[model samples]
Target: MDKITIQNLEVYANHGVFPEETALGQKFLVCAELWTEIRTAGRTDDLEYSINYGTVCQEITRFMKEHTSRLIEAVAEQLAEYLLQTLPLLKGITLEIKKPWAPVGLPLDTVSVKIERCWHRAYVAFGSNMGDRRSHIDSGIQVLRDDPAIRVGSISDMIVTEPYGGVEQEDFLNGCLELETLLTPMELLAVLQKAEQKENRERLVHWGPRTLDMDLLFYDDEVLEEPELAVPHPEIPKRRFVLEPLSQIAPYKMHPVLKKRVKELLEELSDRE
Candidate 1:
Protein backbone atom coordinates (compact mmCIF):
# COMPACT_ATOMS: atom_id res chain seq x y z
CA MET A 1 0.00 0.00 0.00
CA ASP A 2 1.30 3.45 -0.91
CA LYS A 3 0.74 6.53 1.23
CA ILE A 4 -0.06 10.20 0.74
CA THR A 5 1.24 12.29 3.62
CA ILE A 6 -0.06 15.59 4.97
CA GLN A 7 2.18 17.23 7.54
CA ASN A 8 1.49 19.87 10.19
CA LEU A 9 -1.71 21.27 8.78
CA GLU A 10 -2.72 23.80 11.42
CA VAL A 11 -6.26 24.41 12.67
CA TYR A 12 -7.81 26.68 15.29
CA ALA A 13 -10.49 24.85 17.22
CA ASN A 14 -12.35 24.91 20.57
CA HIS A 15 -11.73 21.39 21.86
CA GLY A 16 -10.81 21.18 25.54
CA VAL A 17 -11.76 19.83 28.97
CA PHE A 18 -11.63 23.14 30.80
CA PRO A 19 -14.36 25.74 30.30
CA GLU A 20 -11.79 28.51 29.70
CA GLU A 21 -9.94 26.39 27.20
CA THR A 22 -13.18 25.87 25.29
CA ALA A 23 -14.10 29.56 25.47
CA LEU A 24 -10.77 30.63 24.04
CA GLY A 25 -9.74 28.66 20.96
CA GLN A 26 -6.34 27.01 20.60
CA LYS A 27 -3.99 26.02 17.79
CA PHE A 28 -3.73 22.38 16.79
CA LEU A 29 -1.52 20.52 14.33
CA VAL A 30 -2.89 17.62 12.35
CA CYS A 31 -0.94 15.09 10.35
CA ALA A 32 -2.36 12.33 8.21
CA GLU A 33 -1.04 9.36 6.26
CA LEU A 34 -3.60 8.10 3.78
CA TRP A 35 -3.05 4.57 2.48
CA THR A 36 -4.11 3.73 -1.04
CA GLU A 37 -2.75 2.47 -4.33
CA ILE A 38 -1.06 5.30 -6.24
CA ARG A 39 0.47 3.43 -9.18
CA THR A 40 -2.33 4.29 -11.59
CA ALA A 41 -2.37 7.93 -10.55
CA GLY A 42 1.39 8.14 -11.12
CA ARG A 43 1.34 6.33 -14.46
CA THR A 44 -1.60 8.19 -15.99
CA ASP A 45 -0.95 11.49 -14.21
CA ASP A 46 -4.66 11.53 -13.54
CA LEU A 47 -5.94 13.21 -10.43
CA GLU A 48 -9.07 11.08 -10.77
CA TYR A 49 -7.03 8.01 -9.91
CA SER A 50 -5.68 9.58 -6.73
CA ILE A 51 -7.04 11.12 -3.54
CA ASN A 52 -6.81 14.91 -3.63
CA TYR A 53 -4.78 16.05 -0.66
CA GLY A 54 -6.00 19.62 -1.08
CA THR A 55 -9.63 18.58 -0.82
CA VAL A 56 -8.82 16.30 2.09
CA CYS A 57 -7.06 19.12 3.95
CA GLN A 58 -10.06 21.35 3.48
CA GLU A 59 -12.34 18.61 4.79
CA ILE A 60 -10.16 18.15 7.87
CA THR A 61 -10.27 21.86 8.62
CA ARG A 62 -14.02 22.00 8.20
CA PHE A 63 -14.59 18.91 10.34
CA MET A 64 -12.43 20.14 13.19
CA LYS A 65 -14.10 23.54 13.21
CA GLU A 66 -17.63 22.17 12.98
CA HIS A 67 -17.44 19.52 15.70
CA THR A 68 -16.83 20.32 19.35
CA SER A 69 -15.22 17.58 21.47
CA ARG A 70 -13.73 17.78 24.93
CA LEU A 71 -10.74 15.61 24.06
CA ILE A 72 -8.26 15.53 21.17
CA GLU A 73 -8.55 11.74 21.23
CA ALA A 74 -12.24 12.02 20.38
CA VAL A 75 -11.45 14.45 17.58
CA ALA A 76 -8.87 12.17 16.04
CA GLU A 77 -11.09 9.09 16.28
CA GLN A 78 -14.15 10.80 14.81
CA LEU A 79 -12.10 12.46 12.06
CA ALA A 80 -10.44 9.23 11.04
CA GLU A 81 -13.79 7.46 10.79
CA TYR A 82 -15.30 10.34 8.84
CA LEU A 83 -12.48 10.50 6.29
CA LEU A 84 -12.43 6.76 5.75
CA GLN A 85 -16.21 6.63 5.29
CA THR A 86 -16.46 9.61 2.94
CA LEU A 87 -13.31 9.10 0.85
CA PRO A 88 -13.67 6.29 -1.67
CA LEU A 89 -9.97 6.10 -2.48
CA LEU A 90 -8.67 5.83 1.06
CA LYS A 91 -8.13 2.29 2.38
CA GLY A 92 -6.54 3.22 5.70
CA ILE A 93 -5.34 6.18 7.73
CA THR A 94 -2.90 7.05 10.49
CA LEU A 95 -3.93 10.36 12.00
CA GLU A 96 -2.23 12.50 14.63
CA ILE A 97 -3.76 15.47 16.46
CA LYS A 98 -1.35 17.67 18.38
CA LYS A 99 -2.57 20.07 21.06
CA PRO A 100 0.04 22.78 21.56
CA TRP A 101 -1.74 24.74 24.30
CA ALA A 102 -2.28 22.15 27.01
CA PRO A 103 -3.25 23.81 30.34
CA VAL A 104 -0.97 21.61 32.49
CA GLY A 105 1.09 23.68 34.95
CA LEU A 106 4.26 21.79 33.95
CA PRO A 107 5.62 23.07 30.64
CA LEU A 108 5.46 20.63 27.73
CA ASP A 109 5.82 21.14 24.01
CA THR A 110 2.54 19.44 23.11
CA VAL A 111 0.08 16.66 23.82
CA SER A 112 -1.01 14.46 20.95
CA VAL A 113 -3.35 11.62 20.12
CA LYS A 114 -2.64 9.32 17.19
CA ILE A 115 -4.51 6.35 15.86
CA GLU A 116 -4.70 3.94 12.90
CA ARG A 117 -7.99 2.84 11.38
CA CYS A 118 -8.94 0.83 8.29
CA TRP A 119 -11.64 -1.29 6.69
CA HIS A 120 -11.74 -5.06 7.14
CA ARG A 121 -13.18 -7.72 4.86
CA ALA A 122 -15.44 -10.15 6.64
CA TYR A 123 -17.83 -12.99 5.73
CA VAL A 124 -21.09 -13.60 7.56
CA ALA A 125 -23.18 -16.74 7.29
CA PHE A 126 -26.89 -16.33 7.83
CA GLY A 127 -29.73 -18.82 8.21
CA SER A 128 -33.20 -19.35 9.52
CA ASN A 129 -35.08 -22.61 10.13
CA MET A 130 -38.30 -21.16 11.48
CA GLY A 131 -41.20 -19.30 9.82
CA ASP A 132 -40.52 -17.00 6.88
CA ARG A 133 -36.99 -18.26 6.60
CA ARG A 134 -36.09 -16.37 3.45
CA SER A 135 -37.64 -13.21 4.84
CA HIS A 136 -35.65 -13.52 8.01
CA ILE A 137 -32.42 -13.94 6.06
CA ASP A 138 -33.22 -11.10 3.66
CA SER A 139 -34.12 -8.74 6.48
CA GLY A 140 -30.91 -9.65 8.27
CA ILE A 141 -28.87 -8.83 5.19
CA GLN A 142 -30.68 -5.52 4.88
CA VAL A 143 -29.73 -4.62 8.42
CA LEU A 144 -26.05 -5.10 7.58
CA ARG A 145 -26.43 -3.21 4.30
CA ASP A 146 -28.02 -0.28 6.05
CA ASP A 147 -25.16 0.17 8.48
CA PRO A 148 -22.95 3.09 7.47
CA ALA A 149 -19.79 1.34 8.61
CA ILE A 150 -20.49 -1.71 6.45
CA ARG A 151 -20.51 -2.20 2.68
CA VAL A 152 -22.34 -5.35 1.67
CA GLY A 153 -20.85 -7.07 -1.35
CA SER A 154 -21.50 -10.33 -3.23
CA ILE A 155 -24.27 -12.50 -1.86
CA SER A 156 -24.64 -16.22 -2.37
CA ASP A 157 -27.91 -17.79 -3.45
CA MET A 158 -29.87 -18.96 -0.45
CA ILE A 159 -30.15 -22.73 -0.27
CA VAL A 160 -32.48 -25.00 1.64
CA THR A 161 -30.61 -27.46 3.80
CA GLU A 162 -31.54 -29.96 6.47
CA PRO A 163 -30.97 -28.97 10.07
CA TYR A 164 -27.53 -30.00 11.40
CA GLY A 165 -27.86 -30.73 15.09
CA GLY A 166 -30.10 -33.84 14.95
CA VAL A 167 -32.79 -31.84 16.78
CA GLU A 168 -36.16 -32.03 15.02
CA GLN A 169 -36.44 -28.83 12.99
CA GLU A 170 -37.52 -27.53 9.62
CA ASP A 171 -35.02 -27.17 6.75
CA PHE A 172 -33.05 -23.93 6.98
CA LEU A 173 -32.55 -21.23 4.38
CA ASN A 174 -28.84 -20.47 4.50
CA GLY A 175 -26.31 -18.33 2.65
CA CYS A 176 -23.17 -16.28 3.14
CA LEU A 177 -22.24 -12.72 2.27
CA GLU A 178 -19.11 -10.67 1.78
CA LEU A 179 -18.74 -7.28 3.40
CA GLU A 180 -16.20 -4.54 4.04
CA THR A 181 -16.56 -2.95 7.46
CA LEU A 182 -14.83 -0.39 9.65
CA LEU A 183 -16.09 -2.02 12.86
CA THR A 184 -13.92 -4.34 14.93
CA PRO A 185 -14.71 -8.07 15.26
CA MET A 186 -16.49 -7.61 18.57
CA GLU A 187 -18.50 -4.70 17.28
CA LEU A 188 -19.46 -6.65 14.19
CA LEU A 189 -20.63 -9.53 16.35
CA ALA A 190 -22.84 -7.20 18.34
CA VAL A 191 -24.44 -5.93 15.15
CA LEU A 192 -25.17 -9.46 13.96
CA GLN A 193 -26.60 -10.45 17.31
CA LYS A 194 -28.84 -7.42 17.33
CA ALA A 195 -30.13 -8.31 13.88
CA GLU A 196 -30.90 -11.82 15.03
CA GLN A 197 -32.76 -10.54 18.03
CA LYS A 198 -34.83 -8.29 15.77
CA GLU A 199 -35.96 -11.41 13.87
CA ASN A 200 -36.89 -13.18 17.13
CA ARG A 201 -34.09 -15.69 17.21
CA GLU A 202 -34.25 -18.04 20.20
CA ARG A 203 -31.74 -20.22 22.01
CA LEU A 204 -34.10 -22.51 23.88
CA VAL A 205 -32.33 -25.52 22.40
CA HIS A 206 -28.84 -26.04 21.05
CA TRP A 207 -28.94 -25.87 17.24
CA GLY A 208 -32.71 -25.57 17.65
CA PRO A 209 -35.11 -23.83 15.30
CA ARG A 210 -34.71 -20.07 15.16
CA THR A 211 -35.99 -17.16 13.15
CA LEU A 212 -32.44 -16.05 12.29
CA ASP A 213 -28.88 -17.20 12.83
CA MET A 214 -26.00 -15.05 11.68
CA ASP A 215 -22.45 -16.24 12.33
CA LEU A 216 -19.16 -14.54 11.71
CA LEU A 217 -17.34 -16.93 9.41
CA PHE A 218 -14.25 -14.91 8.58
CA TYR A 219 -12.70 -11.51 9.11
CA ASP A 220 -9.81 -10.76 6.75
CA ASP A 221 -8.24 -14.17 7.28
CA GLU A 222 -8.08 -13.45 10.99
CA VAL A 223 -8.22 -16.28 13.53
CA LEU A 224 -9.94 -15.24 16.71
CA GLU A 225 -11.18 -17.20 19.70
CA GLU A 226 -13.04 -15.25 22.32
CA PRO A 227 -15.59 -16.13 24.96
CA GLU A 228 -18.47 -14.80 22.87
CA LEU A 229 -17.18 -15.08 19.31
CA ALA A 230 -14.93 -17.17 17.06
CA VAL A 231 -13.62 -16.26 13.64
CA PRO A 232 -13.15 -18.81 10.82
CA HIS A 233 -16.25 -19.99 12.72
CA PRO A 234 -14.45 -23.09 14.14
CA GLU A 235 -16.74 -25.43 12.20
CA ILE A 236 -16.44 -24.22 8.63
CA PRO A 237 -14.94 -27.50 7.40
CA LYS A 238 -17.65 -29.58 9.02
CA ARG A 239 -20.73 -27.58 8.03
CA ARG A 240 -21.72 -28.00 4.40
CA PHE A 241 -24.49 -25.46 4.79
CA VAL A 242 -21.91 -22.77 5.60
CA LEU A 243 -19.18 -23.82 3.16
CA GLU A 244 -21.50 -24.29 0.20
CA PRO A 245 -22.68 -20.71 0.18
CA LEU A 246 -19.33 -19.34 1.32
CA SER A 247 -17.62 -21.13 -1.55
CA GLN A 248 -20.00 -19.57 -4.03
CA ILE A 249 -19.08 -16.03 -3.04
CA ALA A 250 -15.49 -16.51 -1.90
CA PRO A 251 -14.14 -19.74 -3.32
CA TYR A 252 -10.58 -18.53 -3.03
CA LYS A 253 -10.81 -17.05 0.45
CA MET A 254 -8.13 -18.67 2.59
CA HIS A 255 -8.66 -19.79 6.16
CA PRO A 256 -6.12 -18.22 8.48
CA VAL A 257 -5.63 -21.31 10.62
CA LEU A 258 -6.34 -24.17 8.22
CA LYS A 259 -4.55 -22.41 5.34
CA LYS A 260 -7.02 -23.78 2.78
CA ARG A 261 -9.35 -22.11 0.36
CA VAL A 262 -13.11 -22.14 0.91
CA LYS A 263 -13.60 -24.35 -2.10
CA GLU A 264 -11.02 -26.76 -0.81
CA LEU A 265 -12.72 -26.92 2.54
CA LEU A 266 -16.03 -27.55 0.86
CA GLU A 267 -14.52 -30.31 -1.26
CA GLU A 268 -12.94 -31.95 1.78
CA LEU A 269 -16.20 -31.81 3.66
CA SER A 270 -17.98 -33.37 0.71
CA ASP A 271 -15.45 -36.20 0.62
CA ARG A 272 -15.87 -36.90 4.32
CA GLU A 273 -19.55 -37.55 3.80
Candidate 2:
Protein backbone atom coordinates (compact mmCIF):
# COMPACT_ATOMS: atom_id res chain seq x y z
CA MET A 1 0.00 0.00 0.00
CA ASP A 2 1.10 3.56 -0.74
CA LYS A 3 1.17 6.18 2.00
CA ILE A 4 0.44 9.84 2.63
CA THR A 5 1.95 11.28 5.79
CA ILE A 6 0.83 14.42 7.64
CA GLN A 7 2.72 15.37 10.76
CA ASN A 8 2.18 17.88 13.56
CA LEU A 9 -0.52 19.93 11.85
CA GLU A 10 -1.31 22.26 14.72
CA VAL A 11 -4.67 23.58 15.89
CA TYR A 12 -6.02 25.34 19.01
CA ALA A 13 -9.08 23.70 20.47
CA ASN A 14 -10.99 23.33 23.75
CA HIS A 15 -10.57 19.69 24.84
CA GLY A 16 -9.81 18.95 28.48
CA VAL A 17 -10.99 17.56 31.78
CA PHE A 18 -10.64 20.89 33.65
CA PRO A 19 -13.25 23.66 33.44
CA GLU A 20 -10.49 26.25 32.93
CA GLU A 21 -9.12 24.16 30.08
CA THR A 22 -12.51 24.41 28.33
CA ALA A 23 -12.85 28.18 28.94
CA LEU A 24 -9.33 28.90 27.72
CA GLY A 25 -8.32 26.85 24.67
CA GLN A 26 -5.07 24.92 24.19
CA LYS A 27 -2.88 23.82 21.30
CA PHE A 28 -3.50 20.41 19.67
CA LEU A 29 -1.34 18.71 17.09
CA VAL A 30 -2.47 15.97 14.72
CA CYS A 31 -0.41 13.46 12.74
CA ALA A 32 -1.92 11.01 10.28
CA GLU A 33 -0.82 8.30 7.85
CA LEU A 34 -3.29 7.51 5.08
CA TRP A 35 -2.85 4.15 3.38
CA THR A 36 -3.99 3.24 -0.12
CA GLU A 37 -2.80 2.13 -3.54
CA ILE A 38 -1.46 5.21 -5.33
CA ARG A 39 -0.39 3.49 -8.55
CA THR A 40 -3.16 4.94 -10.69
CA ALA A 41 -2.62 8.44 -9.38
CA GLY A 42 1.12 8.23 -9.95
CA ARG A 43 0.74 6.82 -13.48
CA THR A 44 -1.85 9.37 -14.67
CA ASP A 45 -0.74 12.28 -12.44
CA ASP A 46 -4.43 12.55 -11.59
CA LEU A 47 -5.34 14.22 -8.31
CA GLU A 48 -8.75 12.53 -8.45
CA TYR A 49 -7.19 9.09 -8.34
CA SER A 50 -5.39 9.89 -5.05
CA ILE A 51 -6.51 11.16 -1.69
CA ASN A 52 -5.81 14.89 -1.57
CA TYR A 53 -3.53 15.56 1.40
CA GLY A 54 -4.53 19.22 1.40
CA THR A 55 -8.19 18.33 1.60
CA VAL A 56 -7.54 15.81 4.36
CA CYS A 57 -5.54 18.33 6.37
CA GLN A 58 -8.25 20.95 6.02
CA GLU A 59 -10.88 18.44 7.08
CA ILE A 60 -8.86 17.61 10.17
CA THR A 61 -8.63 21.33 10.96
CA ARG A 62 -12.37 21.67 10.59
CA PHE A 63 -13.11 18.70 12.82
CA MET A 64 -10.74 19.80 15.58
CA LYS A 65 -12.30 23.26 15.72
CA GLU A 66 -15.89 22.01 15.55
CA HIS A 67 -15.94 19.27 18.21
CA THR A 68 -15.10 19.67 21.91
CA SER A 69 -14.27 16.46 23.72
CA ARG A 70 -12.89 16.00 27.22
CA LEU A 71 -10.14 13.59 26.22
CA ILE A 72 -7.63 13.45 23.38
CA GLU A 73 -8.36 9.71 23.25
CA ALA A 74 -11.96 10.43 22.27
CA VAL A 75 -10.81 13.07 19.78
CA ALA A 76 -8.34 10.72 18.14
CA GLU A 77 -10.89 7.90 17.95
CA GLN A 78 -13.73 9.90 16.43
CA LEU A 79 -11.45 11.77 14.05
CA ALA A 80 -9.87 8.54 12.81
CA GLU A 81 -13.27 6.96 12.18
CA TYR A 82 -14.51 10.12 10.45
CA LEU A 83 -11.58 10.30 8.04
CA LEU A 84 -11.73 6.63 7.14
CA GLN A 85 -15.47 6.83 6.51
CA THR A 86 -15.34 10.01 4.45
CA LEU A 87 -12.28 9.32 2.31
CA PRO A 88 -13.12 6.93 -0.52
CA LEU A 89 -9.55 6.34 -1.69
CA LEU A 90 -8.24 5.60 1.80
CA LYS A 91 -8.01 2.00 3.04
CA GLY A 92 -6.38 2.45 6.47
CA ILE A 93 -5.08 5.10 8.86
CA THR A 94 -2.60 5.57 11.67
CA LEU A 95 -3.66 8.67 13.58
CA GLU A 96 -2.21 10.54 16.56
CA ILE A 97 -3.75 13.42 18.49
CA LYS A 98 -1.27 15.39 20.60
CA LYS A 99 -2.19 17.80 23.35
CA PRO A 100 0.70 20.14 24.08
CA TRP A 101 -1.05 22.03 26.85
CA ALA A 102 -2.35 19.10 28.83
CA PRO A 103 -2.21 19.90 32.55
CA VAL A 104 0.40 17.31 33.39
CA GLY A 105 2.65 18.82 36.03
CA LEU A 106 5.75 17.29 34.44
CA PRO A 107 7.82 19.19 31.89
CA LEU A 108 6.52 17.15 28.97
CA ASP A 109 6.15 18.77 25.56
CA THR A 110 2.96 16.88 24.71
CA VAL A 111 0.68 13.99 25.51
CA SER A 112 -0.83 12.05 22.64
CA VAL A 113 -2.98 9.09 21.65
CA LYS A 114 -2.31 7.04 18.56
CA ILE A 115 -4.15 4.15 16.89
CA GLU A 116 -4.36 2.10 13.71
CA ARG A 117 -7.64 1.37 12.00
CA CYS A 118 -8.32 -0.63 8.83
CA TRP A 119 -10.75 -2.85 6.93
CA HIS A 120 -11.13 -6.63 7.23
CA ARG A 121 -12.44 -9.59 5.23
CA ALA A 122 -15.17 -11.79 6.67
CA TYR A 123 -17.34 -14.78 5.81
CA VAL A 124 -20.99 -15.05 6.86
CA ALA A 125 -23.44 -17.94 6.78
CA PHE A 126 -27.07 -17.16 6.00
CA GLY A 127 -30.12 -19.34 6.45
CA SER A 128 -33.85 -19.02 6.65
CA ASN A 129 -36.53 -21.61 7.42
CA MET A 130 -39.60 -19.41 7.48
CA GLY A 131 -41.76 -17.61 4.92
CA ASP A 132 -40.12 -16.51 1.66
CA ARG A 133 -36.77 -18.08 2.39
CA ARG A 134 -35.16 -16.91 -0.82
CA SER A 135 -36.52 -13.44 -0.30
CA HIS A 136 -35.02 -13.29 3.17
CA ILE A 137 -31.61 -14.32 1.89
CA ASP A 138 -31.74 -11.89 -1.04
CA SER A 139 -32.87 -9.06 1.21
CA GLY A 140 -29.97 -9.69 3.58
CA ILE A 141 -27.52 -9.51 0.68
CA GLN A 142 -29.08 -6.25 -0.47
CA VAL A 143 -28.77 -4.82 3.02
CA LEU A 144 -25.07 -5.65 3.16
CA ARG A 145 -24.50 -4.16 -0.30
CA ASP A 146 -26.23 -0.97 0.81
CA ASP A 147 -23.76 -0.43 3.62
CA PRO A 148 -20.85 1.81 2.63
CA ALA A 149 -18.22 0.10 4.75
CA ILE A 150 -19.30 -3.40 3.72
CA ARG A 151 -18.85 -4.79 0.21
CA VAL A 152 -20.53 -8.07 -0.73
CA GLY A 153 -17.84 -9.89 -2.66
CA SER A 154 -19.08 -13.36 -3.62
CA ILE A 155 -22.08 -15.58 -2.94
CA SER A 156 -22.59 -19.32 -2.93
CA ASP A 157 -25.57 -21.16 -4.36
CA MET A 158 -28.33 -21.64 -1.83
CA ILE A 159 -28.78 -25.20 -0.53
CA VAL A 160 -31.60 -26.89 1.35
CA THR A 161 -30.69 -28.46 4.69
CA GLU A 162 -32.61 -30.03 7.53
CA PRO A 163 -32.49 -28.37 10.93
CA TYR A 164 -29.27 -29.30 12.77
CA GLY A 165 -30.35 -29.23 16.42
CA GLY A 166 -33.08 -31.85 16.28
CA VAL A 167 -35.75 -29.19 16.28
CA GLU A 168 -39.16 -29.89 14.78
CA GLN A 169 -39.30 -27.25 12.04
CA GLU A 170 -39.11 -26.68 8.32
CA ASP A 171 -35.94 -27.23 6.29
CA PHE A 172 -33.76 -24.18 5.91
CA LEU A 173 -32.44 -22.53 2.77
CA ASN A 174 -28.71 -22.08 3.55
CA GLY A 175 -25.75 -20.49 1.84
CA CYS A 176 -22.54 -18.56 2.44
CA LEU A 177 -21.52 -15.00 1.66
CA GLU A 178 -18.14 -13.29 1.36
CA LEU A 179 -17.59 -9.71 2.49
CA GLU A 180 -14.92 -7.07 2.71
CA THR A 181 -15.61 -4.65 5.50
CA LEU A 182 -14.22 -1.97 7.79
CA LEU A 183 -15.88 -3.55 10.79
CA THR A 184 -14.15 -5.38 13.65
CA PRO A 185 -15.17 -8.91 14.54
CA MET A 186 -17.53 -7.67 17.27
CA GLU A 187 -18.84 -4.88 15.08
CA LEU A 188 -19.49 -7.37 12.30
CA LEU A 189 -21.39 -9.50 14.80
CA ALA A 190 -23.55 -6.53 15.68
CA VAL A 191 -24.27 -5.88 12.02
CA LEU A 192 -25.29 -9.49 11.48
CA GLN A 193 -27.57 -9.35 14.52
CA LYS A 194 -29.18 -6.18 13.22
CA ALA A 195 -29.76 -7.75 9.80
CA GLU A 196 -31.31 -10.82 11.39
CA GLN A 197 -33.53 -8.65 13.55
CA LYS A 198 -34.78 -6.89 10.45
CA GLU A 199 -36.20 -10.24 9.33
CA ASN A 200 -37.81 -10.85 12.77
CA ARG A 201 -35.30 -13.40 14.07
CA GLU A 202 -35.98 -14.77 17.51
CA ARG A 203 -33.70 -16.53 20.01
CA LEU A 204 -36.21 -18.39 22.12
CA VAL A 205 -34.55 -21.81 22.01
CA HIS A 206 -31.02 -23.06 21.41
CA TRP A 207 -30.75 -23.69 17.68
CA GLY A 208 -34.53 -23.60 17.43
CA PRO A 209 -36.19 -22.67 14.13
CA ARG A 210 -36.21 -19.02 13.19
CA THR A 211 -37.01 -16.61 10.39
CA LEU A 212 -33.36 -15.84 9.69
CA ASP A 213 -29.99 -17.08 10.95
CA MET A 214 -26.85 -15.18 10.09
CA ASP A 215 -23.64 -16.43 11.67
CA LEU A 216 -20.16 -15.00 11.57
CA LEU A 217 -18.09 -17.88 10.22
CA PHE A 218 -14.65 -16.33 9.90
CA TYR A 219 -13.17 -12.87 10.30
CA ASP A 220 -9.86 -12.38 8.51
CA ASP A 221 -8.69 -15.78 9.84
CA GLU A 222 -9.23 -14.59 13.39
CA VAL A 223 -9.76 -17.14 16.16
CA LEU A 224 -11.83 -15.83 19.05
CA GLU A 225 -13.45 -17.63 21.95
CA GLU A 226 -15.66 -15.11 23.62
CA PRO A 227 -18.80 -15.97 25.55
CA GLU A 228 -21.23 -14.42 23.09
CA LEU A 229 -19.38 -15.13 19.86
CA ALA A 230 -16.84 -17.54 18.37
CA VAL A 231 -14.94 -17.10 15.14
CA PRO A 232 -14.37 -19.99 12.67
CA HIS A 233 -17.87 -20.68 13.96
CA PRO A 234 -16.68 -23.53 16.28
CA GLU A 235 -19.02 -26.05 14.68
CA ILE A 236 -18.54 -25.19 11.01
CA PRO A 237 -16.33 -28.20 10.38
CA LYS A 238 -18.98 -30.58 11.69
CA ARG A 239 -21.93 -29.05 9.87
CA ARG A 240 -22.28 -30.05 6.24
CA PHE A 241 -24.74 -27.22 5.62
CA VAL A 242 -22.12 -24.62 6.50
CA LEU A 243 -19.11 -26.43 4.99
CA GLU A 244 -20.87 -27.24 1.71
CA PRO A 245 -21.85 -23.69 1.00
CA LEU A 246 -18.66 -22.14 2.38
CA SER A 247 -16.62 -24.56 0.31
CA GLN A 248 -18.29 -23.28 -2.82
CA ILE A 249 -17.13 -19.73 -2.12
CA ALA A 250 -13.95 -20.23 -0.08
CA PRO A 251 -12.82 -23.82 -0.44
CA TYR A 252 -9.23 -22.91 0.20
CA LYS A 253 -9.81 -20.68 3.24
CA MET A 254 -7.56 -21.93 6.04
CA HIS A 255 -8.88 -22.38 9.56
CA PRO A 256 -6.94 -20.33 12.02
CA VAL A 257 -6.89 -22.86 14.86
CA LEU A 258 -7.05 -26.13 12.95
CA LYS A 259 -4.51 -24.96 10.38
CA LYS A 260 -6.33 -26.80 7.62
CA ARG A 261 -8.10 -25.65 4.47
CA VAL A 262 -11.90 -25.59 4.29
CA LYS A 263 -11.74 -28.15 1.47
CA GLU A 264 -9.71 -30.47 3.66
CA LEU A 265 -12.18 -30.19 6.50
CA LEU A 266 -15.13 -30.74 4.20
CA GLU A 267 -13.49 -33.84 2.80
CA GLU A 268 -12.81 -35.15 6.27
CA LEU A 269 -16.42 -34.62 7.30
CA SER A 270 -17.68 -36.27 4.12
CA ASP A 271 -15.51 -39.31 4.79
CA ARG A 272 -16.94 -39.60 8.29
CA GLU A 273 -20.52 -39.56 6.97
What is the C-alpha lDDT profile of model 1 across 1-273, one tens digit per residue? 999999999999999999987888899999999999999999999999999999999999999999999999999999999999999999999999999889899999999999999999999999998888888988898899889999999999999999998999799999999999999999999999989999988789999999999999999978788999988798888999999999999999999999999999999988989
Which residue pairs collide, candidate 2?
Answer: none
Note the Cα lDDT for every prediction shown: 0.94, 0.90
Worst 10 residues of 1 by lDDT: 129-138
Question: What are the per-model C-alpha RMSD values against the true structure?
Answer: 0.8, 2.6
Q: Can you write out model 2's per-residue Cα lDDT over 167-247, one digit (the tens) per residue?
A: 899999999999988888888888888888889888998988888889999999788989989887989889999999999
| TM-score for each of the candidates | 0.98, 0.86
